[model samples]
Target: MLSTRRRQFVNMLIFLLLILFILYSSILARFRTPEVALDSSSGSFLTKTYLGLENEQAQSELISGSSLHNEGQFVSGNPQSSLSSLSSSSNEPETINKVSTAGVPSDDVNNRNHISAEISSERSVLKSEKKNEVEEELHRILSISPVVIFSKTRCPFSVRAKNILLKKYSIDPAPHIVELDQHPLGSSLQKSLAALTGRSSVPNVFISGQSIGGCDEVIDLDQKNILATKIYELGKQSIKVQLRQTT
Candidate 1:
């Protein structure tokens, strides 16, 4: 009987130990962290550098600045200009495109360039005096009228803009129309207009020598019923200026 009791106790202890071992293994598995092996060459998970974004230089500067800030050092002044600069830089391509397009007149303009602006002596300039004469002639032309339309006769947009201004609304001191396509210095003038107005297209309408933009802009103003009001208000201001000058 004593021998039987010893065997039974040994068996109970072994069973208990086996149960404990199983429980410990299961608990360990539930709490265990799996190791992940990242393969950079495979282009899978973990080490793609572009994940930081394409603006790596910007990011590095930001990180470096943050570190400097943490260290209580002078980082940078007016970082706000960074965004403004980026915006302006992004618009550079459009400005270049405008200059290029204005430098070369349209197909119709190439042939009609001998038609002349008011048939004035300023039609042609000597190469030696070209730049100064161009500026001076443009200034003279702008002062001829309170409202001016730099137009290309064959351009549909130009025609539309003229129709809107001439027929739809009655403007005082009648707009001076410079058929740019007919002018000798047309391309130069167009390019200058691009520089001045940020628009390379014809039908560049000006009030008091300020460009209001091309056809689409005119249409937008018309749609809003502000075109007449704008013209009248600008004309009124021009009159006031003249009166002030006379006084």
Candidate 2:
């Protein structure tokens, strides 16, 4: 009584329903089987074991033998046992504890050595800097003439020395009178002069490329009539004349 197309559509719907019923029955049958679940559990266990072995190999390659022991204990969920094993494998527990305590002294010694080395390196650098400064100062001092007197304005000894040089020899020690107290480079100049002369006294006197000592020393040399003679002799031995002739 139905047309051909309608008959075909009805048949197709029946086939689909039958297929779905078969799939539902198969699912129920699978759930009912305890053996199927056991098989799945076994497969999962095998996969986990295979992956665990690969991970173990990778870990072993990364960590050292002693460290591997700790890793294994951790992976096995027995940290207490791992630490106990590490301690027990060594000497007696008290001796092991003593050795651990003794490590502090060695660490202290190492730190001290490092500090000492740093101090030594700093000292070496300071020495080099001081040497360079001294050399530069010496070069500057020798290059000039006409009595370069490095003195402090506030110093009585410096004032006395300047008066004596001006009054006695008719020599105006100006234009070269480096008044240290008034100048910004006062402290540094004083320190350098002291270092060079090997004397901590003030009023460092230089006349014709020669160190004429402090105020008292200069006065004594002048009184003894040796100052003028020394100055004249130094003038003849002029560094400027020598350099000019060489050029």
Deviation in Å, model 2, residue 1 alpha carbon: 99
TM-score of each model, paired residue for residue:
0.45, 0.44
State the local distance difference test value for candidate 2.
Answer: 0.67
Give candidate 2 regions above 4 Å deviation. 1-112, 167-175, 180-198, 221-226, 237-247
Q: Please give, for residues 1-247, the per-residue lDDT of candidate 2 as tens digits.
A: 9999999999999999999999998998776434444455566767666666776776775464335343344222356865776677665544322323456555566678899999999999998887677667656754665577778888899899877665555443332677878756466667777776776667887766567788998789778877666655655634221111222
lDDT of 1 at 50: 45
Task: Indicate the worst ten consecutive residues by lDDT in candidate 1.
Answer: 238-247
Pairs clashing within candidate 1: none
Count of clashes in candidate 1: 0
For lDDT, the strongest prediction is 1
Each model's lDDT: 0.74, 0.67
Off by over 4 Å in 1: 1-128, 238-247
